[model samples]
Target: MIAVLRTPRFLLRQPQLGDAELIARYLNDYDVAGNLARVPYPYHLSDAKAWLRTRVPGLPVEETNFSIELAGEGFAGHVGFHRGPQGPIIGYWLGKPFWGRGIMSEAVEASLDWFFSASAAPVVYSGVFHFNAASLAIQTKLGFTETGRSTLLCLARGAELEHIDTQLTRSVWKARHT
Candidate 1:
């Protein structure tokens, strides 16, 4: 277990095996599956088991996967900051049941704060698909600026021809937090 990252109505923390069932629900949603290249539409229990084995939660928030918890529920969605040699990347998805509720935004803010405060990475980049307005809005709300665009041949869903690159730098994060 890790120290919790608290928001007014949510808690961002390391994930556990118990969260697999709920996380499967979120990953099975096309809205989430389509944008992310790794998720398969028909997410399965085995997939969840493999995910748990990846040990995303046991590592630092800046280097591992984490869960979005909504008070009573243990996990609402998946949100995490992953580190690379260059910097960190943002990856997240909310259960369809929890969409349209501003929950993801709060979770993103909390995660970004954790990343900037804890890691050596100077920035965090998020791959926001052009059609995903909610996700783009979430990035903007967190002060991520439009950096550029990318085209990925997603293994799960073929080519995503309209992916936009968005990023938030340490300087920008510091400016906003101050």
Candidate 2:
């Protein structure tokens, strides 16, 4: 599929109706599902469709929830932003098999670049389960700094959680201008 922005190895695009199974297989892994708050443990096709159907309030469907697609090695992961009280909240996840391959970092950098370009705001933010070293490393590689923290109450996981809050600012991006 044609994406709004295609990185050298990944494609940042809108979610398609038929991507249910593709989304489920990667996310349903217990190792993978534990890191994110929203994705269910079972990760059914219906769950994928329900998520895809969630549109931003008062905004059209196209403006929200962009999915990151990896085409070369397969559709390996997803990246997207959602509305937050402070600003836009960026999120992403790659299947465990794709970990350590530098795939998610490429996708995240591309997503941050796009977010900075599209918004008047000068920064992008991400949060991760503090224990997710891989995600923290990927965010660091993409120029995000650990600037804050929060607790996420995961009903599915059935616990209070501590998460690392990371941010990439326009100033940082400008400082590293390519």
Candidate 3:
């Protein structure tokens, strides 16, 4: 079983097969998918099923997926890290109804705490589409510095778009939170 990380308003739990339906419901929304780089528009139940089947709890934190669940509600979104071209990059998105609630910020902090505690990597990177201001703000508030920019394919947008790359090092993270 995966360990659960709790905050005041949310629980970051390992993604499970049972969550596929709820995951599909939230991800099918254009507003949610558009902000994500990999999620395809018109997301389907099959997509969620396949995605959930891949999440293995015992893996390193960088490869584990967390389903952001509200205290009383079901799945609200997702946050996790994957092996990016340069290093381990974190990524996340919320259901449209849950947007603007600062939930992602909390979820990310909890995830990063777990990640930095478990991994030896000195830095974690995240890239946001130029249009995703809310995400940019969340990363900025988390102490990630702007590293650079590049054009990347947006599966949802169906084109390559300019992305702002940002990174947070272990030393900076420790210093700020100390």
Q: Which stretches of candidate 3 lie above 4 Å from their native place?
A: none
Q: Model 3's lDDT to the true fold?
A: 0.89
Best first by lDDT, ranked? 3, 1, 2
Of the candidates shown, which would achieve the greatest TM-score relative to the real structure? 3
Per-residue lDDT tens digits for candidate 2, residues 1-178, read 2237787877777776666677888787878888887776877778877776764244422244556666766567788877667677788888788888887778777766766776777777777888889888888877789888899865447677998888878898878777
Higher-scoring candidate on TM-score, 2 or 3: 3
Candidate 3: tens digits of C-alpha lDDT, residues 3-81: 6899888899988888899889998988888878899988999999999878865776678778998977888999988
Error of 1 at 158 (Å): 2.7
Deviation from native of the Cα of residue 20 in model 1, angstroms? 0.9
Computed on alpha carbons, the lDDT of every model, listed in order, comes to 0.78, 0.74, 0.89
Off by over 4 Å in 2: 1-3, 55-63
Model 2 is weakest, by summed lDDT over 10 consecutive residues, at 55-64
In candidate 2, position 17 carries an lDDT of 68
Off by over 4 Å in 1: 56-61
In candidate 3, the residue pairs with backbone N, CA or C atoms under 3 Å apart (3 or more residues apart, or in different chains) clash, namely none
Ordered list by TM-score, greatest first: 3, 1, 2
